[model samples]
Target: MRTPLPGVAAACGLAAMLLLGACTATGRQASDGAAVAPSPADEAAQQSTVDTKWGPLGPADRDLIVRVRQAALWEIPVGRQAQRRAARTTTRRNLGEIARRHAGSDALARQAAVKLNVPLPDQPTPEQQSWLSEITGKSGNDYDRTAIARMRTADGLLYASIGAVRGSTRNTLVRAFAEKCEPAVRARLKLLEGTGFVTGDTLPDPPQVASAPLPGNPKQPASPAPAATALLAGR
Candidate 1:
């Protein structure tokens, strides 16, 4: 007789549950008992598809990811270094999960860029259009339509997404960015609140969120939300 791998089975079950939760809006519909189909993230994780080829993220983009993750760690309240470690681990884990599952990071970044008015505060015409088109290139990744993407800039990269997630996992990247990034993200939030994030340009300063301290880290950047976190908060 074979022994049951309870732990392994439990982990797998949790993952599936979380993944389904990622699309709460869609899942909600399914919960209503409509017999909805599985999602791309689920299909990809379960079965390989030749039609979908995942792209490699550049170093700059990865850096932005790290930056945002860090900001999130410090923002959350903690009593010890171990607690901080837990927060960071949680943030990165959730970030990776979001990136893999729902294409969260890109979604937040695109939203933030638009809301924050990512175009340079100086040049406001063709340059902005060119940059906008560059980031918004039609259908870059399956995640592009949904991931949290951070835009690079002279000052720093801009991040955007639709929702956020809770610990253990951020069911939605948007919620993660919103809660962790907080007041600063709100302050750094651009006046472009209405402009198309992927198309509109930033003026100068892009409306700094604050001139004071980071959420939990008062000694941190005046508007110090991670580039990725900022993207989440932007929208």
Candidate 2:
């Protein structure tokens, strides 16, 4: 069987818990202030929680938060390397902007981790360190290409995780954090794409809804079309 998406699994698990809690609260109370055995639904809900990590979040939300912080930490050093090693003026400028953006994102991620009482790593994950080493070993056009490709891959993975957290996280803090960082991540991806080093296949899928037309655009209205139209057009 195909594995369920993390967000979906988390949502189902959360819903089951809420339903179980509601049932327990309304359950018949015994004479000695003792609670009766849980119903089958309650048993199933308890089991669901066991299937995933439980706290203020399910497994998916916790994983997403960790990955986001890791990505932020990873990007800062890699972006700096790109700034120093990229030969093209445009590539160097874009990398500089990327480094600046991720520095800010790293701070935000740290703040979120503190508020959520989550422990964040002092350095990037092992896989990220490997990518950094590979990028650092190249120079000129090769460095530019390698750097952009690595960033593209990282951004794509972050994009997917952020999208998942924003949509299904039970914790309000995590949802808000994901929403806040999405635009910068998206903008960085676009900048990397503009460098012509990353290919379309390597990038994450574009947003389903097209952005509003610019002020002077005549072919399309400034206001977005109906959501359905945008979805259909994307397809």
TM-score of 2: 0.63
lDDT by residue for model 2 over 53-155, one digit each (tens)? Answer: 3335544454555666777677777777777778888788888788888776777778877765555666665556767788899988989987887787667
* Alpha-carbon shift of residue 220 in model 1 (angstroms): 53
lDDT of 1 by residue, 27-97 (tens): 11133324345577754433321221122222222223333443333222111222223223433333333
TM-score of 1: 0.18
Provide backbone clash counts, one per model. 37, 0
The lDDT, on a scale of 0 to 1, for candidate 2 is 0.65
lDDT of 1 at 143: 20
Best by lDDT: 2
TM-scores of all models? 0.18, 0.63
- What's the residue-level lDDT of 177 in candidate 2? 82
